[model samples]
Target chain A: MTCQELLDLLHDYVGNELVIESRTTVEVHISGCLQCGTLVHAYTHTVRVARALPKCNPLPAAFEARLRAMIEPELKDKPAE
Target chain B: MFDPPPEKLTPEIVFREYAPRIYNIARRMLGNDADAEDVTQDVLLQVVRKLDTFRGDSQIATWLHRVTVNAALAHRQKRANRQKHESAEADDDVLGSGGPVTPGKRWEVGPEESVLAAEQAAIIEKAIEQLPEPFRDVYVLADVEGLPNNEIGEMLGLSLAAVKSRLHRARLRMRDLLAPHFEGKVTS
Candidate 1:
């Protein structure tokens, strides 16, 4: 496979969406070409770094209070089920 | 974190159980607490409104996720309109359309051996922030949240093909952005 062709399929390869034949083609291409290999390494590494970053959490208590204040009235105003 | 059955679900119960998930989605997309709060509040209120006719659904988490994504994307569009010309060039300038890629730098370190240093995380966050809006949306949902491609497509109102295309380009952009900061394994 050409370098551009490998780049085209790189995302699917990483996502595990490629079929066995396509997967093998990508693996073979990456093995021989250091440049393409670098792209693959960097590509996967980028995803790993991003996934490792701590996600936002706890939902901020003060804001949760404000949200509850808004929604509570709506629920209260509704006739009891 | 279990709660009442769907038929018995209350807005309070939802807030207690799922507010953090809703707020987390918004916080990641909007990139700031202020906007995140605004969208989260709106989604929560909307859920309460829908809960009036609340027939039990087996997958509240999936449904809630769809709601959160739509609200966040709408908020982003409004913000973009208000602050027109924030991005100087087109998205194409930032995202290559599967063009020939020349490998310049090799960030060859294996991730499994590496620890997540806070500084590296901060740099990655900044790179995410710099991505064009469309790419950023797909990247955040697919990579950051680890949602399946089909679900991300549904949430973003994109076709599966479009989702794949944008996501791939987004990763390339991210890889380029971060390569400078990471030392190659062979920097011996």
Candidate 2:
């Protein structure tokens, strides 16, 4: 695999959707190529950082209060089902 | 012994536990707190009134996920003035074919620095928000929420191929946007 071929295959490799033969070719190419290796590493690192994003954004105090006010009446009146 | 699902489903539980999660999903999707708060409130009101809808067969978390996605998408639609910013540089993907990635420009940051990336949350969030319309949706669902691609395609009414394409583009865009921060910062 040349550099462009490897670049074209980067997404498939990152997604783990590449076939084994194609995968090995990519691995072999990057194994010897420092630039491609760093590119691949940085690419994977980007996805990893995105995955590590905080899963919860806490409701601000005023927003929480308003949300409570909006729902409290319905919770009191409606029979849940 | 496990508490009955009913015992666990209370207004307080919804407020204390699920609300933050719903807000987070909306915040990421809407890219702003005001819009997120609106969708969060909308979903919470609906959840409290019909809390038992998912009581028998489905788990509350699963149901909330669907509801939150739907609500956020719908809420974004109501504000449908989002300009088409499909950047001209869509072809300018990171490390694209025939693009030269010189060694001097490659990221020197290693995997161990991932923990520190969280401290750069402002940049991360801005990069995500900058992603043009629909690609942002797929990126959030796949990378942020960790949802399966098929599920994301279903939610977005896109085919599997479309989801894959959008996600790939989103990742490439993200890499280019964040490279300035981490690149050449050889963290020891």
Candidate 3:
């Protein structure tokens, strides 16, 4: 695979979404080309950092209380038999 | 994972268990706290009213995921339309330009910079907010929320190949957005 090809496929490659044959070709290319290898490393690092982002903040207590109040009547309705 | 029968799910239980997760997804998807809360309430209320329709065909979590995604997307669309009507100014620039990506010089994160995880996370979140809607949804589902591509396709009504393509483009854009920060060229 050329560097450009490797760059294009880097996302799937890092995510392990590429088919085995295509993955092997990109792997071989990265092992041989320093520039492509660095680029792949950078891409991998980017995904890792993005995935490691903080979990979403918890729902606010006030909002939760309001949501509960809004839905309480519906919750109390009898279900269809 | 097995879900309890639909009849067994109480609103209180659902709220206690799933509200935080749904809020998180909406918050990330919409990039605003108020909108996220609105989505959380909308999805939870819909779940309450429609609980009887949920057969045991899928896990409750999966069903909730679908509901949350749909509600968040609808909210985003309404907000966009409202913004358009409220201002005569064409806000085309608010959507990203997908500009040319130049790989920055300092591509690799060195050991000295390891402490910047929180800062990097903030930058990454901002970058994600700037991604176009199609790419943003796939990226957030696959990368941020760790949902599989097939599930994301189902959630977004996209084909598997389309999901992969959008995800690839999103990741590339994320890398480009982050390069300048890592290179110390852009300081927040």
Candidate with the greatest TM-score versus the true structure: 2
Model 3 chain A poorest 10 in a row by lDDT: A49-58
Write candidate 3's Cα lDDT for B39-156 as tens digits: 9988888877777665344577777788889999889888878887433222324334323345445354653342446677788888988876778778888888778999999988
lDDT of 2 by residue, A1-81 (tens): 788788777878998999999999999998998878877887787788887777766789999888888887887786433
**TM-score per model over all chains:** 0.82, 0.84, 0.77
Model 1 per-residue lDDT tens digits across residues B103-145: 7667745658445777777788888888787888888888887
| Predicted candidate 2 versus true structure: per-residue lDDT over B1-188, tens digit per residue | 01124544667776777789899888887889999999998888888878665445346666677788899888877776454442322232332432444443566555655454455877889899987767788888888888888888888788897777778777777888888887876733
- Residue B97 lDDT in candidate 3: 39
Model 1 residue B16 lDDT score: 75
lDDT of 1: 0.77
Q: So what's the TM-score on candidate 3?
A: 0.77
In terms of docking quality, how is candidate 3 classified? acceptable
| Candidate 1 error regions (>4 Å) | A54-56, A74-81, B1-12, B52-56, B86-94, B102-110, B113-117, B185-188
Worst 10 residues of 2 chain B by lDDT: B86-95
DockQ of each: 0.56, 0.54, 0.44
Better of 1 and 2 by TM-score: 2
Q: In angstroms, give how far residue A65 of model 1 lies from its true place.
A: 3.6
Model 1: DockQ vs. true structure: 0.56
Candidate 3 segments whose C-alpha is farther than 4 A from its true place? A54-56, A78-81, B1-8, B52-58, B85-101, B105-117, B183-188
Clashing pairs in 2: none
